[model samples]
Target: MNTCLRPVAEQDAAALFTLVDTHRAALASWLPWVAATHTQQDSLAFLQHSVAARQQGSQYDWLILVDGQLAGVCGLHSVSAANRRACVGYWLAPPYVGRGVMQAALQQLCGQAFGPLGLQRLVIDPALANVRSIAVAQRAGFGFEGILRQHLWLHGQPHDAASYSLLATEWAVRQPVQA
Candidate 1:
């Protein structure tokens, strides 16, 4: 299980599109943007936007790789410089599910968010019924903040979401003590 993350690049548009297109049905329920990605061009636009966002210090996205295969994507979005916080989002292909791929990817992303990104709070809001996503957050040491009724609108309908948060201070406490 050699898993890693790399910043999303323009050249990855085709591969990203293929991954999303193949898992559209499974991802559409949890990720709203999956429905809009009907073509490789749409993915290119998304990758381009991610690059721009990183430059503007608004967001950062990365492609998840497991043994050199594009397995998914994860990112920090809705970044607020003044607030020093951001929301985390991710989706994985079905083949990589239940193998701890997302868990490792998420920890790495959170470390970036709380470290050099200089963020204080990291948020993850998964639909209430998305047990797998919620578990990822919990397993990564995020605390259950509360539920936001109808916090997310997916497939033209409002859905309740569970809010989880990991503060930089909390994350720091979880880190191993240095020698």
Candidate 2:
């Protein structure tokens, strides 16, 4: 998919907003933040918040670029330095789906999280009904931990979530050793 991850910046507000606006319906189906991001200003606000979170060492967000174009967004959320863990979340534009772009991006992100970041564990919590997200987590080698009933409030409504996790040890074991 020729995918790469870049730190999201304030300059991306317009493009990010356009992407979200284009996929509002699809994204809002599972991601609550979609509805809230109605304009460029909203995108700017999100980028600002992401920057602040990154500075605080609490979260790291990235833009998924496929073939040099903005394809989606992915990142480590709710990072806990003390626990050496964080949750992963991502969403791709409609046209970029089924192209393995997200899978490649995720694999790279996981590598960074467990390698340079020295994280011990990573979590993926997707709504139970979100089959695509579940498949992405599985394809990334995240193990199913169980379901968290009514775990998230989306658009002011309760939703069940399927929890998945991958440990640093498991990731290391799955990696191909270089000669």
Candidate 3:
């Protein structure tokens, strides 16, 4: 099995901070939420809250690793037990770009969501301009749903996003069990 999502230990905060800083400026090209985070303190607080969220059992954090290096993070930002759904998000280090590391991580996360989280569907919303991210979803078996007009404002302007999704059944059929 792929070890994409693992526990984020307290010691990993430093590396996490570094990653946040290294990509904080340029990452805005694809991620808008990151612009608000401008300092190491901001990232530390984010991680602290994330840890607390995990303990409360309503959320979980997955630190993505590629070739024994920290590549990115992914997790269920929100979860509903009765509704059987969760909102998923992820990002990767620039160095790992063009590789299939994110693809493998996506498959692993999808399996965890469908299996342990009892989620019926996993959804992703990527900005239309973010071709790289949208491509990742396409490769991961998420079919385009539709565009959400002016879904979010980013980099000082409103932007539309293309919604993509994959159902548990679809995930089951698409996952290639690694030998």
Candidate 4:
């Protein structure tokens, strides 16, 4: 459980892309969007954009490191000051999945986001077929709001997704350590 939510630095471009490419084929079963994700050049540019977005205070993206290795990536997207909410997304290297690594990462990031980011709520949308991701949300204390039926397109197919959310007030009452 030695995990952390650290900033996505500019230098992470190559390594992050390596993770994406390595997981590209297999991740589609869980990460539907990975199918539509950019190729090598585009992936590098996207990671660069992630770092740039952090600089502008418009978004916060982090690399999830497990004992110092690039285990995954996590982020708060679409931060809304007026709404006091944000959308969350994450992905872990294939080898790192199902070992409670993502669960730990979610717990750490959710705490920082709800506490320091001044966000009232954090929302996660996982494809219905992605059971592992749904489990992570559940473990991290996100309540199932509803299914956004056919609400998104992944790999050129309409997909149903489960929406989960956790609130700052809710986290304040729960145990700090996510079991």
Find the candidate with the highest lDDT and give its number: 1
lDDT of 1 at 14: 98
- For model 2, the local distance difference test gives 0.93
Cα displacement (angstroms), candidate 4, residue 83, comes to: 1.0
User: Each candidate's TM vs. the true structure?
Assistant: 0.97, 0.97, 0.89, 0.90
Worst 10 residues of 4 by lDDT: 31-40
Candidate 1, 1-179: lDDT as tens digits? 98899999999999999999998899887999998899999999999999999999999999999999999999999999899999999889999999999988988898899989999999999999999999999998999999999999998999999999999999998888989
Model 1 per-residue lDDT at 132: 93
Q: Indicate the worst ten consecutive residues by lDDT in candidate 2.
A: 29-38
Model 4 ranges with Cα > 4 A deviation: 30-40, 177-179
Q: Return whichever of 1 and 4 wins on lDDT.
A: 1
lDDT of 3 at 143: 95
Give the per-residue lDDT of model 3 (tens digit) for 27-76: 76777667767766767777788889878867777899875678888887
* lDDT tens readout by residue for model 2, 1-179: 58999999999999999999988888788988887887899999999999999999899999999989998999999999999999999999999998899889988898889998889999999999899999999999999999999998988889999999999999999889999
Q: After superposition, how far is residue 116 of candidate 4 from its true place, in Å?
A: 1.6
The CA root-mean-square deviation of candidate 1, after full C-alpha superposition on the true structure, stands at 0.9
Q: Please give the range of 10 consecutive residues that has the lowest summed lDDT in model 1.
A: 27-36
Q: CA lDDT of each candidate?
A: 0.94, 0.93, 0.80, 0.83
Error of 2 at 145 (Å): 0.6
